[model samples]
Target: MQALLALSRAIDRLNTFVGKYSIWLIFAATFISAANAVVRKVFDTSSNGFLEVQWYLFAWSFLIAAGYTLLNREHVRIDVLNSHLPKKVQIWIEILGVILFLTPVCVLIIWLCIPIVAERYATGEMSPNPGGLIRWPVWVALPAGFALLLLQGWSELIKCVAFLKGLGPDPTVKADAKSAEEELVEALRQHQAAAGKAP
Candidate 1:
């Protein structure tokens, strides 16, 4: 159990590190897109490679960050009934979800994508659009991303089991920190209150 928990923590750390760095991919994509537009307008020219590379970066960013998002519990969930359930029941439900749903789906996607990426890479598959980027780089993101997500699902499962055994803290709590949505709502409330008081 201790070994499993340690493995879970390591997976969490790996996802956190990857997620933190993956964010820069978005910025890079944005910069490239803007530069492409400016160059097109100013020089009356453009390369499809520039436009396509932006898509590649965006895809990689979104795909690789799945595990990080899971780690942070940022994924959307319909918790109308869930919130009313007992804590242990909720943990059990999550355990079932990770085991039955998340694991299989991630594994399937990764399995399906790996061969396609390999084929593309071996064939040196270039985009049909002239001056465009290679296809394999973007294709590689699918399996790599899902593999990370699968690891995260296992980590989450471990945490849930540990909690049920009374060997660890609640796995469902957001570690006493407000979520991004909550923080945004509070900021809006404060802004509205200040505005009301100003009048």
Candidate 2:
């Protein structure tokens, strides 16, 4: 049990690190996109590579952060139905969901994507656009992302089982950490308060 918990914690840390750094990809994508637009407007020219790279970065960020999102319990849920359920029931549902749905789905995706990614790499596939980037890097993300998700699913399953066995904290309990939207709202409120105080 201790070993399992340690493994789960390790997976959590890995996903956390990936998620934190992946956020920078968004800024990179935005900056590149703006730069592309500026160059296109100023020089009356553009490269498909720049546009494609932005898409690649966006995809990388979204796909890589999926496991981290799950780890933080930030994935979308039917809260209206779930919040009213008993804690034990909720834990059971989580266990079942991870075991039955999340695990299988991620596994299947990883399985399917492996061959495709291999083919892309073997063929050295490049985008149809003349200046666009190679296709394999983006193709590889499919299996890589799903593998991370699969690992996180296993971690979540362990936590759920531990909770049910009374050996760990409640897995269903919401963390105190605020959502991005909530954080944004709080920041805006603080800015407004500061402006009012400026007078």
**Candidate with best TM-score:** 1
Model 2, span 1-199: residue lDDT tens: 9999999999999999999999999999999999999999999999999999999999999999999999988998887987788988888889899989999999999989999999999999999998989999998888889899999989999999998888898767556767789999999999999999996
Q: What does the lDDT read for residue 12 in candidate 1?
A: 96
> For model 1, how does the per-residue alpha-carbon lDDT over 7-108 read when each residue is reduced to its tens digit?
999999999999999999999999999999999999999999998999999999999999999998899989999999999999999999999999999989
Error of 1 at 89 (Å): 0.7
TM-score of each: 0.90, 0.88
- Candidate 1 pairs with clashing backbones: none
Candidate 1 error regions (>4 Å):
176-199
Clashes of 2: 0
Counting clashing residue pairs in each candidate, in order, gives 0, 0
The lDDT values for all models are: 0.94, 0.91
Q: Give the local distance difference test score of model 2.
A: 0.91
